[model samples]
Target: MKFSRQILSSSFSLDKVPGWTCPWCDKSAVSGKKDDFRIIESVQSKSQHSHPEWEPFRITGTFCGTLICSDENCGEQVVVSGLMEVEERGWCDEGEYFSSYEEILTPLFFVPAIKLFNIGNNIPIAIKDAILETFSAFWQDLSTAGNKIRKVCELIMNDKKIVKTYIDKNGKRKEYSLHTRIDFFGKLKKGEREQKAYGLLMAIKWIGNSSSHVNNSLTKADIINGLEMLHHILELLYDKDYMRIYKLGREYNKKKGPLKHPLFGTRHL
Candidate 1:
């Protein structure tokens, strides 16, 4: 596969958006890496289909590209795949620009939740696993995506220890397993920390139940609601603490060592 960097940015009517930036011009200096995309290959397909109304023909191609920093000045290359689609406008109709445009994010491919948590690194294994399925759900099956989102919730519950044990009226000890998803929601409704996640988790749980147990076909709205809710929920559970912990680490690292060493082990490095 041929590799190249493509900047992933939200498109607008404005043409020039991160495809390239002026390195030499200080006034327009873009202070980050570029070319984070690698071209898997260029693909094109042309076909004709009968349209009862106005659909005479359609042509579309998707490019799978590996993502890495193309900025030679800054050397950090991590691989992620994003698909961009190009289509032919000459067949049926045309837009203003070159008769075509590149789609940054589409149902055909999944867009990774960005670096708000850790700059595309330090994402948990569970989240990473769910992410692939989430994309698959986006394009292939809404029902399947809802299931994957529930997995993300389960993982979050495990990581956070959402279950609780308590004392009963008879002076007996009791514990809540939260073993099942229903049990998990029960806990969420009761605790302050868990309450923060209550509404979002409820929606996710409902989606899962609707898709899996009820055997109901999910709507695009259902899938989208679950996806967006999980995004924010994960951020609340995992990401909000990032700055707090980083600052604490910085403070702790600033401390100096003791006057004498017993085992000759350094207290701080």
Candidate 2:
């Protein structure tokens, strides 16, 4: 297992999405505070199939209960629990998706009541810039690696069997590329899969590229649509994990947080 300091962006908060409520505390949920948790364990095991190895990570952290309200009687408490593992096949050079299990807002929580003057800037400019900048950076960074990224996606789309090779009676050795995608999605043909994969992979590539390379020409509407389409594709492949990570992000402004896992408890952190 390995460890790293992956900063969970503050832009994501559980309370902002739907179905996230602190039952124990019985209050409208608060957003996950920035840098509130830590990853404790990570282990990778190569599958016998051709696909890249699978890396599983375990994380734990505490959520500070300060932003929801400032009651003199309410002592600041913390929420400690295990986190979800954000995984990536090879997208980040690290070959694993970075996860804090939960994303907490970073810059800090805001209290509208305390603002003596409204500068018309609802949120902090630096934080807003950071979110946009980081997202655009991902888009820009992947452009140079676009071909490689697409190839990986294609590999996942193809139908092939995982085979191990050994030399004949003579003492020779052999190696070959085998298909690992089958284990994830069984017996599917390439043509049947390519369009689906293309939709998913290309959406990601285009959206990321436009954000990075197109200046600010991308309107919020465009961004939303592109993201929704990408999310739909990711859902087909990754199902809940993919949608939870991507779609849950934009809903932070909603009245309620994203949906919750039956056993994972409230996602307020």
Candidate 3:
């Protein structure tokens, strides 16, 4: 399933809102519990309240709240916590401009973990675990989440039986880098699908590399882009139904029409 970029990037106000995908059902959106948000101002921020130069932007605090799945059949509850900050908002009314400050809640953690995208049962257990871990790290640390994504590349290589170690001319075993293994896998099968998979993996690899370095500027959006590519890769490699449909399409195009079965007559177009 495709992810909702708006939901992932949104910051909440006081009112109950719906956007997050439900981790349990995977078919519903979760909304914040009504008037459930609680904010606790930091001591430093509170101390500045008495200052004449104090402004709403100077406010800083922590917030916690509850979110409930919108689907009544799958009304799962999730707890969320994050930093609270003041945001300046302006609007035009009757050709006049008015500015105001309001509290903004930026989520950093969610209990039971939210699903960023659908993970098929066909996926390997190790890869699934790594992806879940990446989801956990996504809110707290983008870089760590990126590193986890890089680990997924290694796991994919292992599953594909790509050579990881080989005997060198000196009779010593040498390990291959992730890039080399991926390149080898790409070359193992020469086809449009293989080339597409290689390109997607390479993009993910580059993002992962950027995340590993401290000097590199990594954003949540960047990680999300990698996740989207990884989702497509998993579908391309492991989704049996997807592969069957793709094969049928290729056959149809090759014959310029539907194929006929000897016993069943013409196959359905």
lDDT of 1: 0.49
For candidate 2, give the lDDT of residue 58: 24
TM-score of candidate 1 versus the correct structure, residues matched by position:
0.46
Writing each residue's lDDT as its tens digit, candidate 1 over 173-198 gives 88643345446665655644356676
Q: What TM-score does model 3 achieve against the real structure?
A: 0.90
lDDT of each: 0.49, 0.36, 0.85
lDDT of 2 at 8: 18
Residue 126's lDDT in candidate 2: 42
lDDT of 2: 0.36
lDDT of 2 by residue, 1-269 (tens): 01111221213344352112232243433334434444333233223223455223222232323333223344233343323333223334468554333333322222221111111233334433333333333222434323333333334343233344567678788743223332233334344333464445555455444545644455444444443443344344444444445445545535366545432336623
**Candidate 3, residues 205-261: lDDT per residue as tens digits?**
898899879798988889888888888899888887777677777778888876773
Error of 1 at 46 (Å): 5.7
Per-residue error (Å), model 1, residue 19? 8.8
TM-score of each: 0.46, 0.25, 0.90
Listed per candidate, the RMSD to the true structure in angstroms reads 11.1, 22.9, 2.8
